[model samples]
Target: MCERTVRFSEINEIKEFVSAACRCKFDIDVVSGRIVIDAKSILGMLSLNWNEELRVVYDEQDPHFENVLQKYMTS
Candidate 1:
């Protein structure tokens, strides 16, 4: 499994990202004030509080999968 922090300035980009991420399941940690939820559903993504960064967890070594998520990666 690999993990990274990412930031999304636009919500529209999520659909493309989520679709490309189909190969591996992603556990997204959304932190909003006093709440934290492990999100995997697209609908749950909409509930995330937009910020400068969010953590994503994925378990797979597919080069293509990494490539697909590369743009969203931070450092």
Candidate 2:
């Protein structure tokens, strides 16, 4: 599994993230505090608090998805 922290500042970013996730064949999860949501679900991502950092967990490596994640990656 691979994990990374990301933050979305706008709704478009979430949409883009979800779009990228949908292209993947493996499972991807977005975690925040006690809440864990599917990365491919736009509604699930919208429900998260945008002010906080989110943890993205995925089972496999895909360069395309990783590239998308780069845009939102947090230090």
Candidate 3:
């Protein structure tokens, strides 16, 4: 598993990020305090209420996952 902090400050950023990421088969989770949602699902991401740093998690074994993750997350 891998983890990083990410910020999606605008709705358009979230939409574009998700759209670009939808092709890869991986788990994207948005977590704030005690709330967690599927990052791949726009509705699920919006349900978190936005405006918070997100913790992204992905399987470390994925070949292209790291490349895809770098587009949205920061160390």
Q: Which candidate comes out best when scored by TM-score?
A: 2
Question: For candidate 2, lDDT tens digit of each residue in 1-75?
Answer: 899999999999999999999999999999999999999999999999966899999989989999999999999
lDDT of 1: 0.62
lDDT of 3 by residue, 14-43 (tens): 886666557667666667778877767888
Best by lDDT: 2
Worst 10 residues of 1 by lDDT: 23-32
TM-score of each: 0.67, 0.97, 0.72
Q: Per-residue lDDT tens digits of candidate 1, residues 18-57?
A: 6566555544444445666454356766677655577766
Q: Model 1 TM-score?
A: 0.67
| Candidate 1: residue 30 lDDT (0-100) | 41
Give the Å error, residue 25, model 2: 0.3
For candidate 3, the clash count comes to 0
